[model samples]
Target: MSSLKLKRFIKDSFPDNNLIIVSNREPYLHNKSGSNIKVEMPAGGLTSAMDEALRSTGGTWVAWGSGSEDKNNVDDNDRVAVPPGKPSYTLKR
Candidate 1:
C-alpha cells in the first residue's frame, strides 16, 4: 500500500490510540565505536520492514536493548526516542 493509504488506514483504524509494537529484535542498535557511540540497524528483512512501518507512523516499539552501549543512551525510564536526532517514537528497552 501507499504511504497515504497506510496513514489513512491507521487514522481510521486506531484513532486516538498509540500504536505499540513489541518485538525481540531492536530496530536501532547503539554500539561502542571507539570513544563515540554509533547506531546501526540490524541486518534482517523483518527488521527492515518493521523499521519502515515505525518510521512512517509514530508509535512505541518495545524491544530488548541488545547493543554494546544500549544502557548508556536511555533516559531514567529506560526509554529512548528512536531514529536518533529527529525522533518520531519511543523505544522502550
Candidate 2:
C-alpha cells in the first residue's frame, strides 16, 4: 500500500493521540563529509512509510543513534528536532 493510505489508516487508528515509532535502526544516518555532516536515509519500505507518516502527523521517532555525528545533533536528553528548516518531528536518540 501507499504511504498516503498508511498515513490515513494510522491517523484513523489513533485519533486524538500522537504516534511514536521506536526502532533499533535509525531512519537517518549522519556522516561526516569534510567539515559538514550529511544525513542519509536508508532505502527501505518500512523507513519510507514511517517517514511519510511522521512527516504528515508531526510525530516522534525514537531510535538508538549509532551514527558518528548523532551525538553532535542531539540535546541533553539526546533528542533532536529534525528536517532542519521545517521540523515536523523529534528524533530521540
| Model 1: lDDT of residue 86 | 83
TM-score of 2: 0.84
Q: Write the per-residue lDDT of candidate 2 for residues 46-90, one digit (tens) a residue.
A: 887787788877789999888889988889999988766677888
Extract clashing residue pairs from model 1. none
Q: What is the lDDT of residue 90 in candidate 1?
A: 89
The numbered model that scores best in TM-score is: 1
Return the TM-score for candidate 1, rounded to 2 decimals.
0.90
lDDT of 1: 0.86
Each candidate structure's count of clashing pairs: 0, 0
Judge candidate 1 at residue 14 and give its lDDT: 90
